[model samples]
Target: MSLTKAQIVENIQNETGLTKIKATDTVETLLEIIKSSLADGENVLVSGFGKFCVKAKQQRKGRNPATGEEMMLDERRVVTFKCSGKLREKIN
Candidate 1:
């Protein structure tokens, strides 16, 4: 199962002895900063964690699975993530 934000807040509280409210606030703030940075088309690199990059895609053709209809998708930007070498080694 995936870990939820509440679990993260609990972990932070357990590890750092911070109140639940404080932990939640900290986690939310960090996430907001990361999101804003990515929306601004800036990469975010946390030394031991990973790098988050924004990638741009050209307009493309796509098919709707249910209807089997072809469609043209608008150009868009997406976020990509790459694990740091240290993180990859640690996980393995």
Candidate 2:
């Protein structure tokens, strides 16, 4: 199961003995920091966690699956995550 933002706040509160509101605020602030950094095209690397990257994609060709029609895909920026080695080992 995927962990939600609420779960993260709960975990932080439980582990640090922080109030729920404080934990929630901290989590939300950290998330906003990461989001804003990515919005500015910067990579965010959290130690022992993972790295978040923004990648630019060029415009290219595409095909419709059912209709077999050709189309053009617009260029875009995408967010990608790379798990840290420590996290990968822990999961494994």
Candidate 3:
């Protein structure tokens, strides 16, 4: 099963002996910081975890599934993640 945000908060509380509210707030703050950094087109790197990068994508042709019509997708910035070697090793 995929881990949810609530599960993360619970785990943090268990490991750190923090109250639920504190754990939730910590998780929320961390997420907000990461989000804001990404929104600002800045990469976020966490040691032993991963790096989040913002990349620009070119406009491309796309198809509408329902209408079967061709459309042009607007260029946009997207966030990508590259996990640290340590994390990759642990997962393997």
The estimated TM-scores of all candidates read 0.96, 0.91, 0.96
| Residue 17 lDDT in candidate 2 | 100
**All candidates in order of TM-score, best leading:** 1, 3, 2
Better of 1 and 2 by TM-score: 1
For all predictions, the C-alpha RMSD in Å is: 0.7, 1.2, 0.7
lDDT of each candidate versus the true structure: 0.98, 0.98, 0.99
Which residue runs does candidate 3 get wrong by more than 4 Å? none
Q: Is candidate 1 or candidate 3 better by lDDT?
A: 3
Q: What is the C-alpha lDDT profile of model 1 across 8-91, one tens digit per residue?
A: 999999999999999999999999999999999999999999999999999999999999999999999999999999999999
**Count of clashing residue pairs in every prediction:** 0, 0, 0
Q: How well does model 2 score by local distance difference test?
A: 0.98
Which 10 consecutive positions of candidate 1 have the poorest summed lDDT? Answer: 44-53
Question: Pick by lDDT: which candidate is best?
Answer: 3
- Name the regions of candidate 2 deviating beyond 4 angstroms: none
- In candidate 2 the C-alpha lDDT for residue 79 amounts to 100
